[model samples]
Target chain A: MHGKKLALKITSYCFLCLFSLFFLFPFVVMFLRSFFTATESLAIGSGLIPKVFYPKSYLDALDPDFLKYTGNTVIVIIANVVGKPLTAAMAAYAFVKVRFKGRKLIFYTAMCTIMLPAILTMIPVYKIFVDLGWNNTLLPLTVPAFFGGGFLNIFLTMQFIRSLPKDMDEAAIIDGANILQLMFRITFPLIMPVIVLVAVQSFFGAWNDFMGPLTYITDERLLTIPVGIYNKFFTAVSPLEAQPNVQMATGVIIMIPPIIIFCLFQKQLVDGVTFTGLKA
Target chain B: MNKNTKYKDILKTGKTLAALKSNITGYLLILPLLIGLIIFTIYPLLLSLYNSFYLDYDGFNNYSEFEFGFGNYIKAFSGYESKLFFKSVGITFSYAVIMVPLGLVLSFAVALFLNQKIRGMVVFRLIYYIPCLIPSIVNAIVFGYIFNSEDYGLMNTFFASIGIPAREFFYSASSEAVVTFAVMSLFGVGGAMLIWLAGLKSIPQSYYEAATLEGSGYFTQLFKITVPLCTPYIFYQLITSVIGTIQICDQVYVLTSEGGRDYSLLFYGVYIYREFQRNNFGYSAALAYMLFIVIAILSAILFRFNKYVYYEGDN
Candidate 1:
């Protein structure tokens, strides 16, 4: 029995390690190739690692235009990461703590919109943005976040709020705190974990939102990093300069913030996802 | 008696006033969300439905001067566009059909492995999930590089090292584009794997203890207790992922040079996007409505199957 258990353990470990390589291999190659010189990267037999650590590829990838695009992306990220959580938590508080008529109906209506794909709203929303003269600007990408963010964020915040104790909020109300004060002062601080989770999730979502910027922002100057990269590298028949090493370097640069955020908030992110999945 | 009646009237009025106050406060608190829903969701939904029946829209400002009544819908069903539209629909269906189940099963297996009592399991889980942290566009680009058809590409290079021929992955003329996409999607299985891990953790260890005491094997406990209990999450993941896979456009758009060679990768969502790009507002709205209907029907069918899902603590 002992030998059998030992064999099973070994097999499981071997399987896990092999699978880890499968997940990690591309990232490893991405990092290595980014460090290779242009000629070395194109050469199949030049080995997996760079012959010499090349800094020129990074410099070449970080053109002025790319840097500008990064700045635009940052503006978008800040707007969303700040706006989504605050608005979503406020909405969640109304649903959870405030006594309201037709509340269930309204909440269900919001929740049901999750099934409706965003593509359905693309055309009319585009027209509305154009009519409002918000086209070719970052407003299209950022302004809606201030309204209520996505319905999913609101729903997730609501779920988190539901799990909190009701006594705290009742005490605040009894002490003559208005609904807004109860939400902003009492509840918001207590629900900081979920608020942080929503913010981080929003940060990632805004960072990766390519299609929104692609559709709304026609001006080259206003393009986000993802869209700029798509137009700069992928659209043409051949990639710009055909320098795979430079492209890899650009990829490395774009991937850094998300990786850093993941490292910093790994626990919160894991718990949040687990909470969303299990609770929902 | 008159004084008592007057006092009762005041108390009743006070109760009604409090209810009214709470009602207004609730609306006030959710005002931003309410306004957002109306403008972004409700207005657009109604407008899209209305636009689906009309044509000749110079812009949203004037649709009254244009021809109206099922013209766009008819064009979608019968013409040159019809064939392309149906092909795209077929591709979307097949991709979703293949991917949704494949993702669920594979992630479930990974979760089972990750859930095992062992050292470094958390580290393994984190490593597995790291791929999901990277943005999809970057992921598409990296995968495009790795799966490039040339001998210099990563996959081809590895294949050549082992004496296999280079495979055309998402190349312009590649017929294997959909399959290649499916393979690329496996890298992000970590998201679903995390969900499945949550589900697995929810299953009681006491159940396994009971099973072991009855001399049942590991596989037996897994199938009997674990799988049955996991059906609820499996159902949840199924509905969400099916909706997701069907609407796949960003990856296809980024990877292919205009919807792949021979339109092999022209998904329904991309087709809608193309129509909208051509200023075909009515046509695109019609297409979007069709997609909404398809998803609604699919969700309804899945929910119908919810009877088989086992919920904990339910009789």
Candidate 2:
């Protein structure tokens, strides 16, 4: 039995290591190739380290237009990271503590929209934005976040709120706390972890959102990081051969914020995923 | 008797007033969400359904010129558009069929290993998760560069180093495009792995002890104990991933620029996007409805056949 256990442990380690490398391969390649000279980036077996450590790619990637795009991305992320959680929590609080006639009906209706494939609504939403003249502006991306946030965020938060003891709410009510006051002061503080989860998720969602920005914002000046990077690296109009190193640099830069955020909230994120799975 | 009746009526009116006040407050608190749902989700859904009937695209932005009929839906069903639509739908289904199971098995295996009490397990888990943390667009770009069709591509380079011949990936032939994407799906398996790990952790250690005492080996325990217990998690992953993979647009769009050679990578989402970009609002809206129907039916079927999922208390 001891020998068999040893064998199993060894096999597990081996498999884990191999899969780790497999998962890490693209990031490794992205990191290394970003520093390579233009030709070396395209070359086969160009060694792990670049012949000349190139900072030119990094410099080129930080051009004024790219910086502006970064700003645009930050604005969108901030709008969502703040708006989504706040509104989602408010909405969640309503569902959990507040007594209303249509509360169940409204909550279930909102939850049902969770199954609605985003593609189903994209066209009409696009038309609505176009008709409103909100197209080509960040309003298309940001304004809706303030409304209800998203159903998923609200759902996640609602679960968290439901798990809280109801006495806290009852006590607050007895103390003459208004609904908003109870949410902002009592429930919000206790549910900060889930709120953080929603905020971080929102940050990543807005950050990685390619299609939304790609659709609404046509002006080059207003492009977010994803669309900006696309026009720079992957478009036929702009040849991929122009700057492989720069493309990788920009890609690496774009990946850093999420990685840092992930590391910071790693435990919560993992737990949150599990929580969502079980509850959902 | 009259005075008593008057007091009772006053009490009744007071109670009703309090209920009305509470209802108003509740509605006000949730007003943002209610308005958002109406304007964003409900309105768009209905308008999308409504727009599918109209067919008029002459490059002008005038909605007044649009003719009312089912021409857009009909166009999608009977012609080259029909061929493309069904083919794209078929390709998407195949992609889902290939990827969902692949992801489940691979992520489950990884999660099982990661769940073991071992040194450096956290590092191993984090390494696996880093791929998932990479933004999808960036992942697409990185994969695009790494899987570049030419000899200079990173994978091809690795093949050369290992004495294997270079193979064209995602570019050479339409046959390999979907497969290439299915293979690329491996990178994002960390998300599912996390859920699987949660499922594994929830399984009581006593079950394993009982199995061990019965002289059941590792494989037996895994198959009989761990696998059965994790079925609910598997069910959830299946439903979510099926919906997700069917809506695959960004990766194909970002990687190939236009759905690869022969439109082999043009999944339904990308097709909808392309039509939308081309200003075929009615056609794309119709296509969007079709996708909605497909998803709804699939989800309904999955939920209907969820008897295989084992909840602990069910027995």
Candidate 3:
């Protein structure tokens, strides 16, 4: 029995290691190739490691045009990261603590929007933007975020708030705190972890959003990273097609921020996922 | 007695006024969300539904030429462009059917393994989940290059190293394209794996201990205790994955140029996008609605299985 158990453990480890390799292999290749010269990338029988490192590939990939795109992406991300958590928390607080008629109905209505796919509303939203002359501007991308950014964020926040003991609220109320004061002073501090979770999620969403920029931002100057990368790599029949090293380099650069955020907040992110799954 | 009655009336009115004030405060708190929902969600949904019945856009006049009575829906069903619509539906359906089950099983298995009390497990979990952090566009691009059929492609080179013939993946036949896409999507199973892990952790260890005492083997315990207990989570995953897979667009949009060879990879989302690009807004709206209905039906069917799910609180 002991020997069989040992064998099973070994088997499981082997399977896990193999699966990890599969998940990590593309990233490894992408990273390694990002430092390779244009010719080395295409050379036949070349080993995985480059013969000579070309760190300049990063610089070359982030030319002036790409820099502008990166800047645009940063603006969008900042607006989203700040706006989503702030507004979502407020909305979640209202749903959880504030008493009113039709509260459950309103909350459920917001939750139901999660089922309505974005593509279904793409056209009319686009028209709305056009009518408001908001196309080609960041408003089309960032303004709606000031509202409850996503139902998921609000719902997660509500769940977190619901988990907290109601006695805290009663204590604050007894101490002569108003509704806003109770929410902002007491409940907000308590749900900071979830707010961070929402911020992280919103940051990633804004950073990686391809369709939003693809549809709304028409000018080349106003393009975000994803759309810019698509145009740079995929759109043109570029002479750089042979130099996929540079393309990979661009991808690596764009991937860096999100990876850093993930590493920095790994615990919160895992906890967030666990919280969503278990609670839901 | 008159003075006392007047005082009582004043107290009653004060209480009513305070209630009204609280109600107003509640409304004020949720005002931003209410406005957002109306503008971004509710209005757009209604407009899209209305637009689905119209045909053609007058770009100069800034109005959609109305074609009443489901003309756009008919076009999607029986018009000349219906070929692409139907083909995309067939492709998306197969992709979802294959991808959802494959992803769930793989992630669940990974979760089971990771749940073991092994050293360096956190590192393994992070490594597995790193792919999920990468953007879908970047994921698609990286995979596209890796699976590129040409000479410099990684898959072809690896196959060559092992003395196997290289297969054209994305450029291959329809069935092959579906499999290739599904396989690429499996790279981001980390999210689902995390959920599964949470579900696994939530199952009480006492159940396993009792099973062991009763002479139940590991596999028996897993099936009898762990699997049944995790059904709620499994059900949740099923519904979400179904909804997500039905609306998949980004990867297909990035990987394929001009809708792949003979539009073989034209997914429903991509087809809707193309219709919009062609200024066929009404037809695209109809397509979106059709996709929505299909998702709704699939979700309804899956929700039926919720009765079998075991919740710990129920007992």
Candidate 4:
């Protein structure tokens, strides 16, 4: 048994080390790409690990769109922070705490909506936005968040609300606390962790969302980071008709703000994933 | 006894009405959510379902002019779109094949490494998570340079240092395209790592103590104990991954398939997306619905395996 244990430990260590390297290699490659030089490209041996390091990749990435893209991303994020979590929390509070006629039936119907793939709704939703004349506006981008339309948010809020003790709600009701008061005063404070979860998630969802902004926003001035990155690489009529390195530099810049935010909230994020029944 | 009886009797006459009041609050609570659902969601869903059954193209114009029938489904599954449908199904299948198992194994292994009583484990976990938060558009750009035909890639330089010939990793079966995607997916393994960590936390320390007393070593404890306990976690991650990969777009759409590589990187969701982009809405909805069906059927099959799962504390 002792010998077998020793062999197993070694195998576990070996497997773990190999896996870490596998997961780490792409980041390693991304890091190296950030440092590559044009001088090395002519070296016939110029590698991603530069013999000469230049800050220019970072420099080049900070273009005219840098501020514009960053500003747009920030606006959406702020809108999402205010809109997504609060709406979802209230809605979730309703689903869990409130009891009404046909309540279960209605909740079940909403839950069934969870399985309707967003891809299926893309065209019709876009058409609705277009017909409403909100297509080029951030209204299309940020408005649905106000009502807990994103079921994932609703689900997370449900989990948080489900975990709270029921007695507090009973006491509040005895004290004549309205549903809104019970939510804002009692339930919301208790589910702070989930609120944090929803905020961080909504921020990232709005931040990293390429397809949403791509499908909806067509104006140059209103371009979000994801769309900005694409425009940098794929712009047809521009003189810079697609240079890979410059585009990557833009990628480097685009990745930074969210990366920083994720670092700060990685703990909640991990917890949030597990707590929300992510696997199920 | 007096207070209890009085309290109980005080509300007796109004019991049904009070119950109705609470229920009304519940209805009111969900009112906003229901409204949004009807407008932004259910309405759109019905519209898509309606659109899918029609013939709508330039030879057809827009929604105002299109004729409704089973013609769209016919066009979708007919011989003309058969190759498109099958190719998409095949591509999505290949993608899931590479992604689901790969994500599970990689996430498991990385989770184990992080779980180890290693120095700086938190920082190490954080380092691994950086790529996941970078967003796919950024990921695509950086990788495009890293694998730009191997002529300018870091890997090529690394290979040349070892006397190996420079290779076009993308166009070849050593397929840089797939490699890029796999790399991108690895970054998002943070979610998976957390699940494994939760599983790790849920394990009773007493189990390890007992194993040690029986002269079992670390490996026996891990494989015989930790890994088995973690099977449920592994199973969950695998299922979500299977579903996620089926609807994958955006990363491939905004990233690679842009540069005349249309036919090459043509994924199922991406193919459907292009149909929409080209104003081929009818065709796109059909494909999206098909994806939904495939996902539902497969998830049901996987979910059936849930009976075998041994969740702790159930007994």
Give the best candidate by DockQ: 2
Residue A24, candidate 3: Cα error in Å is 0.7
- A1-280 per-residue lDDT for model 2 (tens digits): 7998899999988898899889988888888878988878766677457998997899988888789999999999999999899889888888887788989999989978878888777777877888888887889889988888888788888888888888988898899987778888998899999999999999889988988888888778888888888887766453346577888888888888888998899888877765573534
Report the alpha-carbon TM-score of model 4 versus the true structure.
0.88
Estimate TM-scores for all models.
0.95, 0.94, 0.95, 0.88
Taken over the whole model, the C-alpha lDDT of each candidate is 0.84, 0.83, 0.83, 0.72
Number of colliding residue pairs in model 4 = 2
Q: What is the RMSD, in Å, between candidate 1 and the native fold over all Cα?
A: 2.1
Q: Please, what are the lDDT tens digits per residue for candidate 1 over residues A1-280?
A: 8999999899999999999999988788788888888777777756577889998889989999899999999999999999999888888888887789988987888887888888888778888999888897889989888887677788778888888898987898789988778777877888898888899999888888878987888899999898898888775565435677887888888888887887788778777765573433
Label model 4 with its docking quality class. medium
In candidate 2, which residue ranges exceed 4 Å CA deviation? A44-48, A236-241, B1-7, B56-64, B159-166, B312-315
TM-score of chain B of 2: 0.91
Task: Provide DockQ values for all models, in the order shown.
Answer: 0.65, 0.68, 0.65, 0.53
C-alpha positional error of residue B39 in candidate 2 after TM-score superposition, expressed in Å: 1.3
Candidate 1 structure quality by residue, lDDT tens digits, B1-315? 999999999999998898899899889878888888899899999989888888645345478777889888888889898888888988898888888898888988888888989899878987898888877778866887788877678888889988998888887454588888888889889999988888888888999999999999989988999999988888889898999888888778888635777788888888888788888888889889989998999999998878888877777
In model 4, the clashing pairs are A99-B23, B57-B60
Interface RMSD of 3: 1.8
Per candidate, the number of residue pairs that clash is: 0, 0, 0, 2
What is the lDDT, from 0 to 100, of the residue B189 in candidate 1?
95
lDDT of 3 by residue, B179-269 (tens): 7887888888998998888889887888898889999998999899889988988998999998998888877888884567878788889
